[model samples]
Target: MDNTKLNDSDPYSIRGSHPILRGQWITLEFSIIIKTYYTDSTKVEYRDLENQRIQNIQGLEDILNSEEIQDSEKINVFTNRLATLKNRLDVLEDLLKTFYLDTSFLDHVKKVRKEIVNEKG
Candidate 1:
C-alpha cells in the first residue's frame, strides 16, 4: 500500500478500502499467535516484540506532534513506520505458520503446561 496516495481526511485511509473484517481477522490472528508465547521463557521475547511495536506507535505519535517537520515529511515518516509494522505482522504470520508446521512447538507448549501444573500442585 502506497502511503503517498493516502487521503489524510479519510478515516479509512490506513486500511484503504478494505472491509472491517480484514482488521478483525488480523487482530484475531495476532491474538492467537501472541498466546503461544505464554511460557515464562518466551514471555520476554514477546515483550520485546511488543515493545518494538509500541515504539513504532510512539514514533508515529512523535511525528504527528512535531511542529518542525513539514506535513509531507510526516507522511513519509508515517509511511516508513506503517511498512515496519506490516513487516512485523508478516513475521508473526510466518511464526504462526512455523508453529503449525513443526511438532516441536507442541513440546514447548507441553513443557510450559507442565511447569504451570507443577507450580499449581
Candidate 2:
C-alpha cells in the first residue's frame, strides 16, 4: 500500500468547524461595534453628563458645608439637575447593556458559559 494519506489538503480538515468559526467572528464583530458605540466621545453624551454631575455634586457639597447661609433656590436647582443627570446616566447604562451583551470582558462569565454549554448537557 502507498504511504500517502487521503484528504490532507481538505479545507474542512484544516479549518475544523467553519460555521462555528464564522459565527464566533460575527459575534466578535458585533461586540466590537457595540463597544465602539458605547465609547465614542462625539455620539454619546454620558461623558459630559457625568462630568457635570460630579462638578455639581462637589459644588453642592461646598455650598452646604459653608459657614454662610446657602441660597435655597440654588440648592433646589442643583438637586434637580443632579436627579436629571442620574436618570440620563441610568438610561444610557441600560442601553449599553442591551446592546453589548457579550460576556468576554469578564473572564469568569465567559468561562462559565463555555463550560456549562459545552459539557455534558
Candidate 3:
C-alpha cells in the first residue's frame, strides 16, 4: 500500500503446497494435508494469457481489500476501478471455462485466489 506497486512482470506463484502425510503407527490409515500453494517451477507455463489476466485482476482485488489501503485519499477511485476489473475478469473466466482443459491452469488460478486472499502481495 505504499508508493510501491505489486510486481506483475514475473509470474507470481504460491510456494507452500507440498503434501504432508500422517498415519498412526498401529493403523493402516493415513491422511494427507494438501497445502494450497505449489512450489513447482514447471507449472508456470500452464498459465495462459487469460489466466494471467485473472491473476492480475485478483491482485487488484487484493489491493482493494487490504487494510493499509482503506484510508488512502484515493480510496473510492481505486475501489471503483478494481471492482470493474473484477467484474470483467469474472465474465471472461466464465467464457473461458470450456476452453481451459489442462488441470495445471486450474491449479494456477486456485493458487492465485489463495495467495490474494492471504494478502501475499
What is the lDDT for 38 in model 1?
48
Distance from true location, Cα of 1 in model 3, Å: 55
Which residue pairs clash within candidate 3?
none
| lDDT value, candidate 1, whole model | 0.52
Best by TM-score: 3
**lDDT per residue as tens, model 3, 71-114:** 66667777777677556545544444434445676576667656
lDDT-wise, the better of 2 and 3 is 2
My TM-score estimates for the predictions, one after another, are 0.32, 0.36, 0.37
Better of 1 and 2 by TM-score: 2
Q: Encode model 1's per-residue lDDT on 1-121: one tens digit a residue.
A: 7564574335554454555544654544554554544422233233336654323333454565577667786678786875675466457755555535445764665576467557635
Cα lDDT of model 2 by residue, 15-63, tens digit = 3345644445444544443343334412322233544322333344455
- The segments of candidate 1 whose C-alpha lies over 4 angstroms from its true place after superposition are 1-45, 48-51, 55-70, 101-121
